[model samples]
Target: MSGLPDILLAAVTGFGCALFFSSIPVGPINLTIINEGSQRGFKWAWFIGFGASIMEAIYCALSFTGFSSFFGNPGVKAVMEVLTFVFLLFLGAKFLFVQSVNLPATPLRAAAEKIEARLEQKLHPRSAFLIGFVRVMGNLGVFLFWIVLTGNFMSHDWVADALWPKAACVGGVALGTNAWFFALCFAVSRGHGRFSEATLLRLQRLSGVCLLVVGLFDGTHIVWQLARHRMALTS
Candidate 1:
């Protein structure tokens, strides 16, 4: 392929991969955006996506620059897993018990109520951004995912290792990620009026349950690995 075509292919590959992955609704980031959009509105929820996309781009760049080995280290991976487990546990419990989304009869009053609740650092635009960023940071799975994806892309020669192609791919990833979040937030916020507070609260609780399940799964895996290692040593 020629130079421009190579760049385009890399960009398209990145975009498609990002879009496909981001569309998966299992992650904490997705749930947070949904909760925020349904509770607050689009503007505040969208900033979460902004911060997430930026971190995603950084991860992509690191992957492209061959920093995958850093995250691949056993010690680093163990630390990340522990951190992720703890964070998931805490966030899951919080979401499970969070009372009232501040939904009032009037949108204005609802907004006012939300702002007042946010004074306790519950939810706001800036905090939403930080929440997104922090959530992704604790999510070691995302970093490992990028590592594997970029490695596979390079191995197949689907994306050239040249700086330009890699940069284009990273940019495409950021855009693709942000696009999904925007669509999700838009849909939830637009239809926010259709759902009762009870239903919204149920969804939030469901998200918490799912997160806790994932964290438990991870913990189980870690324990199993340790047990196997111990057996090997004993043998």
Candidate 2:
């Protein structure tokens, strides 16, 4: 650890830790990336990672700049939390209901191909990118994520208020996210054939159920907190 290398080394280390901690969680974004990676291919996974990482970088910057305070208001925060809960439940329901039953043999394969071809046409690179971006952006929880991360950094006095450190950290997050998605996509791609359609369908249903439970638990917790806070304010 000497000269510019010291700073660079520290930045890289910080980046890796942040990325690992942020990505290791079993969130909606991870679920989406893994699902798409297995069903689609490398390209699909890359785009999802690209879009999500870009947005994540933006969130990091916003957090560093203290722009996420908009959600600090109680009413606004509660509303956003409820919305997130609803989205989680909705996404789960969709996954649970959309069962891809096995089709008949050769004759039906032709018709399925035709339909798949149409789906392929629609799921262009741009579409994949948009889906990733929208999926991450629509969730208000991410705003809180960066806000808390930045706040923790500030409290720890880890990095100064300099621009370069912030940029480095953000870049590190993007790189880390990309790395995780790469691994996930590669692993899922390997299982493409081994997992039958029914298995995938069950996995989807299981994901939905997990998400639904998460929403219910979180929604209740948030409501309880809100009630307590309201009581405190009144008292």
Best by TM-score: 1
Q: Report model 2's TM-score to 2 decimal places.
A: 0.54
- For residues 22-131, write the lDDT of model 2, one tens digit per residue: 44424556667667877788788768877777777787778877643444454655566666667667766766676553322454445544554554456643567766
TM-score of each: 0.58, 0.54
Q: What are the per-model numbers of colliding residue pairs?
A: 0, 0
Q: Write the per-residue lDDT of candidate 1 for residues 1-235, one digit (tens) a residue.
A: 3499889998998998787667655455777787788889998888887788888888888887975445445675666566666766775786678686542254544554354445435443357787676556555567767876676556445677577888889989998999999988898899883556577677667767866886798688778878999999999
lDDT of each: 0.73, 0.62
Which 10-residue window in model 1 sums to the lowest lDDT? 116-125
